[model samples]
Target: MTSDKAHNLWHQTCAEQIAAPVLSGDVTVDLVVIGGGYTGCSAALHAAQLGASVCLLEADEIGHGGSGRNVGLANAGLWLPPAEIRKHLGDGPGDRLVNLLSDAPRLVFDLIARHGIACEAVQNGTLHCAHSPSGLKDLQVRHTQLKTSGAPVMLLDADEAAARTGSAAFHGALFDPRAGTIQPLGYVRGLARAAMQAQALVHQHSPVLRLSHGAGMWQVETSAGSVRAKSLIQATNAYHRNLSSTAPEYVPVHYFQCATDPLPEELRATILPEGEGCWDTGLIMTSFRMDQMGRLIIGAMGDLDHLASSIHRAWVRRKLIELYPELQDVPLRQGWHGRIAMTSDHIPKITAIGPNAYAAHGYSGRGIGPGTVFGKGMAEALLSGNDISLPMPAIEAHHERMTGARQMFFETGATLTHLIKARF
Candidate 1:
């Protein structure tokens, strides 16, 4: 059921966007990365560029996970604000990550340019729309932090927000010139292609069933074959197949998106006229963006593929109309969901599971930039045999995984809220 839901909508739309071939036969390498999403591909690209023999394995095609289904926002930072991050990770490590990713959009766009990646890369900017007065207050705080950190950002009044987003649902907005959008699937595929061109071996349809550490190397066993590498990186993030005991502990949060049939040119001209990706400032956050073909895609908190599919569908319809009253008749052509491996703290982590072996995941819905940044950092760390390869200092391990009633409590609460919202 989960797999079906993953492939039914936007996933189907992205079928031909990736580059080729699944892993077969056995080969050895300096590094073996499991999971070929943004992180794995980036790790391969960076590792190989640094003169390391690299092999990346993907269970499905490249971009089969959240990397493809993403809303395409190349945001600069994580979900946490600078102050909150500093509070949690201390001024040193938190500020380091902040500094690294503050320039992440530049790195992303630069890579796209250098590779001539065909992803529809747009760098105009991104808007964080305020859903309420409280939301605006939060943005104001963020605005201050961003400015203090020398980010190119601007605060927009409600009128300006409405002009930019073509909606009055937001009270205000904070615009970050450093952020942008892309054809997400294309970007991941392009990364894989570039890595391959750089002599990194990437194979799809290769699922690692087990990982064992011995003989001064990590052995990854797959149905088709096996690989032995000096180091291993678990880049599976959310779509992991639970193939090993070293799986990262995380809360599985689901985010779904529905895409409208291409709007008429007139409607497209009004909605996201500046061609910026926009997301809201609510606890249950929402995102909206127009694709190159003018499909107005809107996404929110709950998984559309869950048992509450009807409720999620209803909310999509109503939310569309509420956001753009004039588009009341816009037909939603596709709907899909992907799991986000969210840590209790909503940050990505690098965990040293064993000697010379590590696992990385828990992006908490902020992937693209962080994924690339972290992947490259992981590669450098492995190559250099030092912990300093990461932008943020690596944590030995995250807090104990949320379990039992706690997990169900979150799922039930989210489902209940989604149902309630749809009903009203």
Candidate 2:
């Protein structure tokens, strides 16, 4: 059972649980990883599998941050369309990233099958639903671009989309056979379990107090213990704390989700019958999916702790009725929120903090596939002394300006949008 402090549905429903004692003494290893989210756990697992002695430290429980609180869509690519990605990063690098992430869902599912992770793994597919006519046009372009890049994607018109989603609200949808969903917290915890089986030391409630490097070794100090290693990986993302100098810089946007009680079998038979995850094309995006027990999960961009949280909640209630009038009386069973490390260009980044230490962040809300792939790539690069396996070259530093302003802009915009847009 999950601790009472774990207020999210994922924690309560997660089938995988790992018990890691807090650090109490000094330890030495080839690599020391900070943070217990997907990237950190994946890095630890891959590094250990490569025969590197590894130590992973987490400030809280595994998947305590965004990894635990996300919408559970193990999507295939970034939020930006292919052309926009190419525009931000030129053709060569853009195409490379696109191709790498195009097959990311396969990598994720294969790992689940190989490790026997029981995280409600489903490989059916995902839908990019169109919220408006303009949104349909956008999906049309995305379908063309994805197909041009060899993705087996199908564009569905209004009738087809309505039939698949069990709602007449969407004008269309783009179906990608490569994408899927999972119980995210369970998946991350499963990775940690696998890493432990490979002889990696994992410590929970071990926050790094200070870090220093000299003579080709990193000295990481925590409250109760310390770690010395030749390399380090910081995978904290938006939940980073206590390490300001080396922490990633990005606009911290919040995303909140609400889940309903399991619907009757008849209702479940009609809604998302094929078990595909879904999200719509809107500036303030919304996501929808069903858990293994038939609970309908819906999410949007906004902070649930803000004063405007009531407005967001009200909007969700009304939005549910708008999408499915039959669900008008269904009360939300759980609601929670997490932060996203968003970049101006909506791309992930790997920054070289020091000689052999790297900090990766800025997934812009596309965490699962990219995080796992980047973590494995980082482990390979660090252990082999070659970075050719990395999807993108690591940079010296990455900076984001007006991050506070941008974060507020997103929250305020989401609040205003939710306040007025979903009314009957």
Please, what is the whole-model Cα lDDT of each candidate in the order they appear? 0.83, 0.91
Runs in model 1 deviating more than 4 A are 1-20, 404-407, 422-424
Clashing pairs in 2: none
Report the lDDT tens digits of candidate 1 across residue range 285-359.
789998878899888877655676677778778888888999988888777777788887777888887777677
Among the numbered candidates, top lDDT falls to 2
Q: Estimate each model's TM-score.
A: 0.94, 0.98
User: In model 2, where do residues sit more than 4 Å from their true spots?
Assistant: 1-6
Q: List all candidate RMSDs to the true structure.
A: 2.1, 1.7
Window of ten residues with lowest summed lDDT in model 1: 1-10
Q: State the displacement of the C-alpha of residue 130, model 1, in Å, after optimal TM-score superposition.
A: 0.7
Task: Please give, for residues 70-123, the per-residue lDDT of candidate 2 as tens digits.
Answer: 998998889888888888888988898898989889988988998989899998
Q: The CA-based lDDT of model 2 is what?
A: 0.91
